[model samples]
Structure formats: structure tokens, C-alpha cells
Target: MNYRNLFYALALAITANLGVMAQGHKGPAWLSNAVFYQIYPSSYMDTDGNGIGDLPGITSKLDYIKSIGVNTIWLNPVFESGWFDGGYDIIDFYKIDPRFGTNTDMVNLINEAHKRGIKVCLDLVAGHTSDKCQWFKECASGDRNSRYADYFIWSDSISRKDMEQIRQRNSEPNPQASTRGKWVELDAPRGKYYQKNYYVCQPALNYGYANPNPANPWEQSVNAPGPQAVRRELRNIMAFWFDKGVDGFRVDMAASLVKGDPDKKAVMALWQEMRAWINKNYPECVLVSEWSDPKKSIPAGFNIDFEIHLADKIYNTLFFASDDPWGAKGKECYFDKRGLGSLDYFYKKYADIYTSTHDKGYVAFPTANHDFQRLRTGRRYDLQQLKVAMTFFLTMPGVPFIYYGDEIGMKYLPGLQPKEGSRKRSGTRTPMQWSAGETAGFSTCKPENLYFPVDTENGKISVAAEDNDPRSLLNFVRGLIKLRHSSPALNNDGKWQLVSDHSKPYPMVYTRFVDGETYATALNPSGHSVTASLAHLGKAEKMSLTGKVKYKTGNANDKIELGPVSAAVFKIR
Candidate 1:
């Protein structure tokens, strides 16, 4: 079919399907085809010459972000923090970090973003707070009767010997150890120990335990006064931001709120309550969780959840493999061009999660985030291979979040010193390269003063250079995002079905159904060309090459021949 004819057919099909599925539950209406761009504020753009990125700096770059065809922006934590955990160790929830800008700057940012039709989502660190926070300080004052004393988990006085025993117990493989040695003893009048969720500087807040143990006085019940007070404070924080024009939040460590509940029922209930409050007060606001389990997080009222970097073998199989220079240890990822990885692991988990949450929420697939390496990292340095990965990411049936520099094929600098508690992840959080000039045009400040050094070795990858090249990864990603926005069959609510066998070595085939039309997509991540038969699945008639990939179709038995590191889409008329 001609391009014009195809457009008209799609429009009619979508109109017809909308009538039939009007009653069916889908995620938020605005998120049907929303493309999200994640920006680490400290690394995105530096305008004040203070060696750090700020809110005004982000506001100045809204035009560039909008040009990439993304409608949503997820900013990493900009709250007042000690910079101990890269802004995750928030010291004040209501204020923006001084390094980033003032609270007024954030308000201005939200205004400018909304003017450009872009929604802003701030990162909410709800699980813990910096040890230097006022609340934690108050709790650590040894005043048992202090109003904020129970805001954090505090245990009775423990001798040095007892603390050592607790540490030993934590070191051993004891699944029955109800209270692990996640505590630190404070030298104060009360002389109590407090629990920490992550680093020693981040103390876990008192959200209460799912199953309280009398032996551990710190394990307060969910209904306890302290837990109730914490819930109220969470609501207040959300309301504060919602009132300031912020559209939503991407909650950090969402699943770790409640302790000692393997089933996570209490944590789920806590979020449900928060969701209820959000719906009633800020109806337009949305909530996305960092929780990797969509089956549990979606039902708990999270509008979306990520499917990246969490102990999931399927996730590692698709992106991180043993041979990957940055990865710990594993087989080759499916897109490594090695033909050694299988999609069964990913497909099975995805199917189960999708089946359970298709009506309620979505599972996001980010190109990469601050906590993980970029798509072009390690052995997968070829831009063509990245195009294939982008094909799968953009065409999948969920929200697609592109990390700031992923569109430009940014490389993860190896062996960089840690910054703001970013140990190995420091490489991925490098400043965005806007040009090939000094400092990659990321900041006008001296190179030594940059928040994080730009990739200067072997010539930096800059946006200006990529903008001039039509075949560059930047332009290719822009094309995929534009296509996703214009096609209902590729939206977040589309139904996904695997057309090729999971055991296939190359040319992975899948069909996305939506608006009464079928969109078949094929990806070949292998080094050589390969043909796959789709006759057993169904007729995929109208074929079209999408992105920067190369492919050919055969009429005999509905087979498709895909070139190395290529991807294509078919209308399936």
C-alpha cells in the first residue's frame, strides 16, 4: 500500500477499535504514546558556571528536549541532599538542592516545561533520608519523647558485644534473621541503634514492619502512631509538589518501604493509600515506581514500573551478558550479535506481567538510567547494534524512557573516580555532550570544575555532530519516537504477541495488535543475515522498513530476510 493509503487505513482502523474497546481499562490516557526522557539534573546542563547542572539550565534546554519528540521528562532527584548518594540522600523534601537551584527555579522549570507541552516528573526518594537530615538528627538526639524520635527506626541500647553478634548473624546465610544488622549504634544518651536501607549515610524511615516482632522494639506495626505519622508526611510531600505544578513522581526504592514482609502486602497497602490520596487531590498526577516487579507494583496503584537492572535474569539476558565488559558475569545479551542469547526468559516474564497488569498499568523499558550503564556501553559499541536495540525499545508495548545521552551513542567512560557516592555508575552519569568544543559544550566552566567530566577521548560524541548526520543514532532515535507517536498500533496499550519461536537465533519476530490493526516487527541482532518464517503465525502482507535497519520480504511462505543489526515493521494488512 502507498504511504497515504496506509495512513487512511490506520485512521479508520483506530476509530473502529476505539468504539469496541472504549470500556476496556488502559493506563493513563496521556501515557498511551508518551515518550519519556530521563535527565540527571547534575549532569544535563550547567548554566551558572558553578560546575553543576541546575533547574534554569534544564529550562534553557527544553527546546532541545522537545525536538527529540518526547512529551515527558523524568528528572533525577533535585531535592536538598547531602550529595552523598548522588541526591538520593535527601535532607529536605520540600526544597530543591542549592547546587541545582532554588525552589523558585523549580517552579519556573515546571512552568516553562508545561508551556512546551511537556510533563515533568521529579524523583521521590521515599525509602530513606540522609543521616544529616533534620528529622534524622532529631530522632538521633536520644530524646525518646521527641516528636520526631519515632520518625525513624530506633532500637534499644545494645552492648558492643551484642552489636558484633548481630553483624555476625547478618554475615551468615540466615533467611530467618528477622532483623538483619542494617543498624548503626549512635553514641548518645539513649545510645540506640538505627536501621539503614542502603549506604551508611541513608537511614531507613519508620514506615513500620509488616510483621512486627516484640523482640525487636524498633519493628513498629503499620498501624502504630509513628507509621501513621510517616504516612501523613508522605502525603504532605506529594501535595507540596502537586501544588507546585509538578505532574507526578518516580518513586525511588518503592518496594523497600515496609520491612520484614516477604509478600510486601504492607508496602503495597501503603502505596495504595498514597495513590488514593493522589487521585482525590491531584487527579492529573501519576505515580511510577522503581520496583522491578510489575505484577506486584502495578496492582498496588503504580501507573508504571521499570523492568531494568534488578536481579531479573530476563533483564540481564536482553542487555547485560557475561562478556559485556561492564557486566558482572553472564552469557551474551540477545542483541550482542553473537546468536547465543534466547528471548524465552524475557518473553515469559513479560507475558506474565503484561497479562496481569495490561488493564491497569505499564512496565517501562529504559535505554539506560543513572544507576546502570548506557546501551552503547562495553562490547555493544556499534551504532547499528544500538539502532536494533532502540527498535525493540521504542516498539515495545510500554513507556520508553531514553536516558539523556543514549540518543547520541554516548560511551560509558571506564575507571572513573566515584562522584557523589556514584561508585561505578559515575561513568554513566557524565555530562551531556552538546558540542565537540572544550568540555563538550556541557559547561562553560573550567574542565576541572565540571560536575562530571565529559567524554573527551577519541573525540567526543556531540549532539551538533550527530544533528548534521542523517544516519546518526540521534536522528534514527528521533525517527523511531516520531513514528511511535503517530501510530496507534505501536502505543503503550498495544497487545504484544511473539510471532517467532523463542529458540530462534536471529530475526526475532513479534506482532503488536491495537486499533484493529496488526503491526509486525522483526529484529536481527546477529552479525550475519538470516531469514525467519512467519507463515505459521499469520499473513504479514504490507511491509515497511523502520529505523535505520535493512530488510527484505519474500512472498514464499511469508518469510522475512533481515540484514545484520537490522529491524523492520510491517502493517500486516
Candidate 2:
């Protein structure tokens, strides 16, 4: 062959291989073993004594975060917002909220975090925007021809009379008319009603639905011009942050984008398109969803989907059980020590999700997020209970997210008035108790001026107090994270096999394998000693164990005895 022809052929072959690699990409390469720490920015710290946490405050604590053995940090919404629904009611996607500092401060935070080898992920609220947003303002200006008129869902007309009729129909006790509801009406110029996602201040963005009808003209189809325009705008918002060295986003209300999408096929398609664009342009940027359905979200291009605090069926079985004093009605969690919790629901669901998306994405399990009560809340207050809970959290198959203050056993305060749309959850969002000082070392602001009150109970939990205690929960978590980072068998991609039957009570056992090494993990969170047959460990050599618990290995085919509230990790040869 001629030299020129040979060079062209080689170039073609390389390009084809690159295309193949891109198509086969499962997820971000860095996420497989990453340990994430989630920070509620407004409550994490306060460096300038403004009574609130900001970017500079977070930047100043990079060392502390890195010391915890977390390599990735997920910051809740920092964008400019009206603070109606925390920071989720974003007014402008590009501007950082003045309460949290300027754009320059954000840049510094990303730079400082990167210096310590920590990746930063921002919270992206894609499903809605504040009613005060410029786009909404323009759309509500009484002109249907406005440039952003279709950016949000708007009814053509719903007069007071129409609303009264709707209310009358809703007031009727007939079960057939149960779905009837009311939409908020806008004043004069707008002359229409708009759909809201949560609070009245937050309006739902129009992403188009799977089906549209004459009765609901506002529900545009997915292929409509308005939906396409919104998609472009979403891309522009993503591109703006990606240029600033942000690693990725934890999308809020990710699965609820498409209105009236019962099966979620249309919303999934939207995410799939966005993921394709992200993979082609910014391949390293990860997309983590708030959606709990990993089977749908992973295939739709999310790198991870959290099973956060929601209903009883999913995560409640592990943490928020029926006996929880927090007033949530649900079955007992396996970690509750009540012996009423079952592993059947959790194991079956996890196994199904793992089988579907183990190679493509992960199902992140957090210690406790801002939306739920902390692990140390309610009746599960003992340090040993937390230790056993941490064992399961850190050893899970997916990436582990540690909510700020959870390591030190922070308690969820009760009976605090609502703030920024946090009702009962407001207690969980209290300022971090850094020390036992008068203000808990969070800030020097006056007691009344503080964003939220610190836990002032006689025996308040604090990082400083925990630091001095070698066997503290904070230290235990640090050790677990270090072990996870060092051992291939405990990382995200390790093979997970259930070693104990789910029907067993008290002790739960599982094994992780990687690179020809097997790591066996056992947890007994109850108050009584439990014995379990570990014939599976007969052929293997025992390695090491951590925690304050006691355990004894019996004969090859005999049962292994674990003391009350104990956990152990053993490497088998």
C-alpha cells in the first residue's frame, strides 16, 4: 500500500476504536471507590461570623474534611435563591448567592478542595425555579409572545369561577373525583394559573410530558419546541459550572422533571440525552440523581442514584423503622436492635438493582441526609448502635456518603420553628457542633442571630470531645473509611455475596471479594448475643477485626458467637 494510504487507514482505525470506547463507557472512572461527604453548606461552618456557612468557610475546613478520609464533597445548593425552600428555589443559575459569598469564593473553594485531592459536587435543582426568577418574571408579564413565556407551565385561563367550581368538585366526598385539585392563580396581567412543585414560591419548569391533551394544553409533548428550548438552557447551565472545575452535580428531584410522566419514560429519555451530551463533551463529569430507582436511572446515564429518606419500603427498613420515635410509621430496620426488622425487602431490592446496574452505576447509601433525622436520633442513641450502623454503611456495595456532623453523633434537635422550607427536618439542619464552647465553635454570632441553635444539651456531642476519645464514633468512621480506601475487597466495585440468610435475626453477614481476596463482614446490633454458623469461613484464614466488640470463631462447621452491639470485618485467606 502507498504510504499516504496507510497513514489514512491507520487514522480511520484509531477513530473507530475511540468511538467504540466512548460507547461502552459505563461511568466515571473515579467514582468506583470514592468516599463522599455531604455538606449542608448553610450549616457546616461560619468563618466570617455571618451566622451562616459559605464557600470560604468550607474552603477553610478542607483539611478537616480530608482528615476524615473522604475524597469527594457534595455541597447542597449554593446558587442564588430566595431561600424559600432552602436553596432549591434558585433565582439565577449562574450567580452564587450573596449569603454564601461571591463567585470568586466558589472558585477558591473548588481550587482549595482539589489541592487536597477532593472532588466537589454541587446540588443542581433542575425540576423547578423560584417564582421570582427572571425567566418567570418575563413569562408572567401578560405577554404570551415573550421570549421565555413557555419556560414554565402556564394555564391559558382559570377564572375565579372555574376555581370555585373545581373546589366544589374537590369538596365532594365521591372517590371518583378525588384527583381534582387547585392551581394557584396569578394576578391581573398574567391572568392565568401556574403549576407548583412544592411551595407556592417554587414553580415547576416545563419539560413536556409523555402525552398531551386538549384539556391540559399546558402539558406539551416531549418533541415540542418549548421542551427542546428548555433542554438547551439546561445544557447551558451545566456548561457554565463545568467550566469552573466543578466535578459534577447531585440533581434534585431528578425523576420528577416531566410533568404527568407516570411511567417516567419521557423523563428518562431527557436524562439519557443529557448524559450522552455530557459523556461526549465532559467525560469525567459525573451525574448523580436523587431518584431511588437505580434500574431506571443508571440506564438513563446517571453515575449514581441515592436511596435517600423517603417511604418505608426502600431505605426505612435499614434506618427509620416502625418503632422510631420520630413519628414515621414503618417496619423496623435490621439495625434497630428491636428484632422486628426484616432484611427480605432490602436484600431483594438491592439484589435486583445490583444485577441491573452494578457495572453502569451505583446505589449510594448515606449515613443521614438533611431531610431525615440523624442516625443517633430517637431510640437508637447508643454509641454501639451507631458503630454497627456505620459498619453496614461503609461496607455497602456503592459509594458511601457521610452527612456532616454524623461522625460525631450529632443529635437532631426537636421542636424548632421552620426555616427556609425545612419543617420537622429543621432540627437536622442545625449548625455543626465543632466544640463544646458556648457557641459550639460554629460562629461567634449572638445566640439569637445564629442561623440555627446548636445542641446545648448537658452532654452535647462535639468534634473536639470526640477527638480526645480514641474509641469515639468519629474515630471508628475514620478507620472504616481508611480501610475501605486501602482494601480492594471493600471498595465500590468489589463482588458482594450474602453469607447469611435474610430470615436470621440479630446478626447480619455478608462477604466482599476482589483480586482473589475475600473480606467477611458481620453485624449484631441487638442487645443480646447472637450466634451464626459461618461454615463459609471454614476454608479461609482469618485476617483482622476492628471496633470495640468481641467475637469468637468456633470449630470449622460450628457457629461464630458475636456479643451484643458488635461488628467485625475479617479477611479470609
Candidate 3:
């Protein structure tokens, strides 16, 4: 064989597999163009008339999901669970809950999703287990010598006051500080107390604490026998699923492990161990984190992580967050239609992360996740206003997740009765409205039997209705998603830079550039119109949500006038 021919073949193979193979640790190659749709399993659909979304139900919608340009599906916790804390409190790591389907159903779902070029990411609760879990039950005995007695953290001596003292150590910038956090007691007085990650029923798994104090005997070292065993089991759990053809996992509360590690060196080390194992065994699999800290999580072994956690006020400033979360209503969010909001704060936070880590990994921004209010909630109710927001979500840098039903302008109905443990979050997770049928195309069961109530007020907001209207939010989202997938500069690895003055953010502008091609996106989500001189950015066919984007040649360049709550994208230098 000629040397030139062999070299050409090698380069071609590497180019084809660049994202996953050539670029090690960046993420799976498929993720470069992946757009995620997060499905709250019980609320997506009910195929068996059991009033709960199942694996088969998701399998049935693969076509619809693909049509909307979603290439990845992040299914929230489908494993066996006690249903407490909305499936975060896992019962069995190996078995799929009968409520969702069998383990084989999951394998089939993965096979079917892979057929459509859709990757499936299951939610992995790596931190803890429900009190009902056999591991928890066995360890709850407080028997120090039992096989699984060390699987979870246990203490019969430390008091609540001491727990508070432990909480005070290295706890300044923490996000998961809820009422049930820190520590909880055994329900039936089992002579032992255990640490709690979220709810009382969920006991924290012992991955070891970072700083093992001599005073706190319950604190185990990161390399102790118990912690070492837990680490092996985590790998065992992941390998079990990976062997069944699962793509990857969205690790829940990823940063909440290795307690007492203020700097989180130990927690990162634990995941790094997991990542190394995955790199060797399942190189194509990816790991996204709920850590909300891209700076740390990306380097710590996650391929992708959240741009902002709900507790972080930075993201809150862009959406429906108030300056004082407990005291007031939402202030001037950039997406709100009042013309009072600005993107300066959010842009600064986002740009810092992008500049530092864009090449190493990605940061994810979901339009509205399980913990967030929908885009159509409260003062942001107008559909045109939402269109502007959707345009930004689709065009922005990094991987984006569209919550199910948000494409059809789903409403966040507040004050609904809670289910399982979804208190206020219940409103954000109502069933998907497939049509205007009697049950909103969710389930054949009676309305009362649903996981929660489907919005009766959203009678005209079903997918069937929106699919018929080109101007509907659903159709607009579909078009935007198609544009994102088709555009070379808009994929995950593209460079993002603020295209407008940060101080004057009314007409928020940004550019995504890759492979020497550039595109500019401008948005005016305020109640009033604004004009900006975008001379440097030449022009191309405009992809817009409103007709208000008027252009005029001013001297040397084009000046764009964006109308109220309008958005447009143009190809430029």
C-alpha cells in the first residue's frame, strides 16, 4: 500500500469520529449536536392505562421526539424507588421499577431509541437510597458487622446540635441546604442516627467524608473500607446498565458526595475514579452532572453540567427569580416583556464559564427543568414573548434541554395538590398535552387518576393544534431547532461571544462561530423596541420570530430595529 493512501484513510476515519474518538474526555461524539428533552417519566404518557408514563410510552414517542430535533432523551430516575422525593430515593440500582416496566423493557427502549439516532440517558442517584431500600434497611440496623452496615453513614452518638456544628464547617457556598438536609434520625429509634441528603426517608450513602475529624467517629475517611466498597458498588451499578446498552447517565446531586470536603477535592476524586473506569470500559458513554458548577464538574470527570443551579441567584436574574427569593415577586428578568430587564448579569456569568471551558466540555441550560417554573408562567404568559425566549434558547451556545410540553406553551398552574413529594414543583410537571382529547391525550384513566392534573385551561394549546399552526410556539420551536441542527456555527463546539454592549442589553446580541462561519442573533424581549448598529455583521437571510426586525443601511453598515419581544438570527462575517 502507498504511504499517502494509508495516511488519507487514517485522517478520514479520525474526522468522521472526531467528536467522540479523536477528542478524548470532551464528551461523546453524538453530544456535539445533541439537543436534550428531559422526560419526567410518570408524567409523559400512560401506555398501560395505569396513569403513569412508562418505558414503552417513551419508546412510542421516539418519532415525535425526533421530529422536534431532539437527539437525546434524559429520563428522570426509572429505577426501583419508594416514590419518595419523586424517585430520587432509589430502592434498587439493578432493577427497573415494576411501575415503569421491567429491566428488559429498559433494554428494549434503549435499543429502540438508538435506532432513531436518539441517545438515552438515565438518571443515576449515586448518592443515597430510600430508607425502604434493602441496603438502607440492612444498614439501618446499626449493626457494625453486617455486610452492608457500612454502605451508609451511621451514628448513634452524634446529636442534632453536633450535626449543626458539622454543617457550619465549610458550608458557605452550598446549594442543597434544605430543611431536611444535614442529618436525620432513624424513624423507629434503632439506636443509630444517619446523615440525610434530601428527605428524611433518604439516607446518605457513605462515599466517605473529606476531613475525618477525630471527634466525629461517624465521619469515615475517603479511602476507608466502607467508602472503598461504596465506590466499587457505584461502578458495579453503572456497568450493569451500560452492559444492557444504555448510553450514559445524568448523575443526580453529583457534588453532594464526599461530605466535609470544602474544596471538594475528594468528591472530584471519587468521580474521577468513576470517569477513568468509564473511559476504559465504555468510552462512548457520557456523564452530565447536577452539580451546577461547570468549572469544577467538567474537570472532575463530567462531560457536561448545569449552567446554573436553582439556588444560584445568577440564573434567577434571567428568569422568574426575585432579588430576595423569600420576600418578593420576580424582578426584571431579561426574558420578561416589561423592557426593564438586562442580560449583563447573566452574560457575565455565562461568558466566564464559556471562555474557560468551552473546549474541554459543555455547560447545559434547560429552558425550564423540574425545579423551574415554565416559560409561560406568571407575567411571561404571552406567546409572542415566549417566542423571543425560545429563539434565544435554541440559538445560544452549549447543549440545550427543552422540557416536555414546553414547546406547546405549557402553563405552570400553581397551588395544585402535591404528589409523591413534589410540593411546589408539582405544577411544573403536569402531563404532556398530546391533543385536545378528553384526557388531554395523557391517559385513558379518569382525570383524577393522573400523576397530576393536566391543564384544562390549555385546551387550545395541545401539540395537535400547534402542529397545524405555523406561527404557534410549538411550530416556532421546531423551526428554530431545525435551524440550530442545520447551521454549522450553532452546534455545541461553536464559539459564543456577546455581540452587543453588555450594559445596553435590551436587544441582547450574541454570535456563534465555528469552521470559519459566523451567525448573529439579536433579541428584544422588552415591551419597547430598540435599534442597534450591527455594521460589522454583514447580512444573510433572516430567521426571525417577528416581522419587527427592520434593517437599514446606515452609512457603512446595517442598523437593525427590533420590535417589542421579537428575535431574529442573521448570518454574518
Among these predictions, the greatest lDDT belongs to: 1
| TM per candidate | 0.90, 0.90, 0.91
Residue-wise C-alpha lDDT for candidate 1, range 1-573, written one tens digit per residue: 257645654553454334223323443578787889999999989998877888999999999999999999999999999888899999999999889889999999999999999999999999899989999998888787887878898777655776885577557763222244576766645446778887767889989998888887778877778877888898899899999999999999999999998998778877776765666567678889999998888767788899987846456778886755445565667878776777878888888888888777888989989998888877688877888898889889989999999999898877888887787898899999898766888888999988878874434478888886888888888888877777788888888888787877577888888778878889988787887776643455544354334334446456777777788876766
Q: Candidate 1, TM-score vs. the true structure?
A: 0.90
Sorted on lDDT, best first, the list reads 1, 2, 3
lDDT against the true structure, per candidate, is 0.81, 0.80, 0.80
Candidate 1: regions farther than 4 A off? 1-27, 157-162, 165-181, 456-460, 536-556
Clashing pairs in 2: none
Candidate 3, 97-204: lDDT as tens digits? 999999989999999999999988899999999888998787776677877878888767776676675565436443232343466655433345678788667788
* lDDT of model number 2: 0.80
Query: Superposing all C-alpha atoms, what RMSD in Å does each candidate have to the true structure?
Result: 9.6, 6.6, 7.6
Clashing residue pairs in all predictions, respectively, total: 1, 0, 0
